[model samples]
Target: MGELVDRVDEQDRVRGVVDRGEAITHHWLHRVATTVCRDGEGRILVHRRAADMSRFPGQYNFLVGGAAEVGESYEEAAARELTEEIGVRVPVRFAFKFLCRGEISPYWLGVHDAVVRTDITPDPDEIAWHAWVTEDELREMARRPTFVADSLYALDRYLSRGEAARADPLP
Candidate 1:
């Protein structure tokens, strides 16, 4: 068995447990948690996926996170991912979630936001390169083909919501 995740229905309700790989291979909906880190000035952190990653290698995204564990709530998973991926431990607020038709798989993406008041220590296994860019710069990044489509979708939704900070309206 691979990493266990809670398989979910279209309504985002827990259905059963499944291997992460199997869920992706079969297009089963599972929970993914991502945190968009912003500095005090609101510049967003964008990063390139590691070249050695099994998925989306060298691709770009405005967030950093991963699949939620079997019983982890979206917020817990987002906080956990922020620590694991970038070594930043801060309180993350629920921004929103949407069903993203990913380039490689389909999953319910729970997007969160964090203000990085301290330094970051990125995991080389997950992030290759990172930089903070203004929202206008991030808006330009959204047009790149090398970027993760699902991430762009998240970014688009996040920006469209008016306030950078908001709670998830989905159940």
Candidate 2:
């Protein structure tokens, strides 16, 4: 299967310049994932990536995520990743999108934050463990453990601007 391709606009769109593979391999690609979780006060959930992951292993991170498959919508991918990673079924809402531009390739990332309440059985291949934290608790923990810098940034942006951050969330 091919990776989903979007047009090259500052915002996501369909353009004629690049093919899906080129954008993903040679260039930075756009992928979407959901941070499906809830808190201890029934507010939010947090998960940690397995320590053995190739990207950011053992990092405090989103509960579920994956690249959008060819012809798949961001919401669909988010929903699917959520189920695959954590065995949860929850409605996903568009929270934010991030661009991970590196010196080489760039990553067009869509981040959705969803609320869910259930026992999370993390896939050993994907995650190590998960927990729920209140907004205050998250703010506190963001200070210590190594987390997805982008996720923390999003949280700060959400708190400060009272609007979702327009900038790409750093990985």
Q: What TM-score, over all chains together, does every model reach?
A: 0.94, 0.73
Q: Which residue pairs show collisions in model 2?
A: 7-13, 7-14, 7-15, 28-106, 37-45, 38-44, 38-45, 39-43, 39-44, 50-58
Tens digits of per-residue lDDT, candidate 2, 1-171, equal 354555344566645434556675666455545554553234566678888875567778543686676567788888888888887777777666766563335655666766664567778898887777766777787776688665664565444644243222322
Q: Each prediction's Cα lDDT score?
A: 0.89, 0.63
Structural RMSD, model 1: 3.3
**Deviation in Å, model 2, residue 55 alpha carbon:** 0.7
lDDT per residue, candidate 1, 1-171, as tens digits? 989999999899999999999999999999999998888777889999999899989989898899999999999999999999999889888888989889889999999878887889999999999999988999898799989878888887888888624433222
TM-score, predicted candidate 1 vs. hidden true structure:
0.94
Candidate 2 wrong stretches, greater than 4 Å: 1-9, 15-27, 100-105, 161-171
Question: Best by lDDT, which number?
Answer: 1
Q: Measured by TM-score, how close is model 2 to the native structure?
A: 0.73
Candidate 1 regions exceeding 4 Å error are 164-171
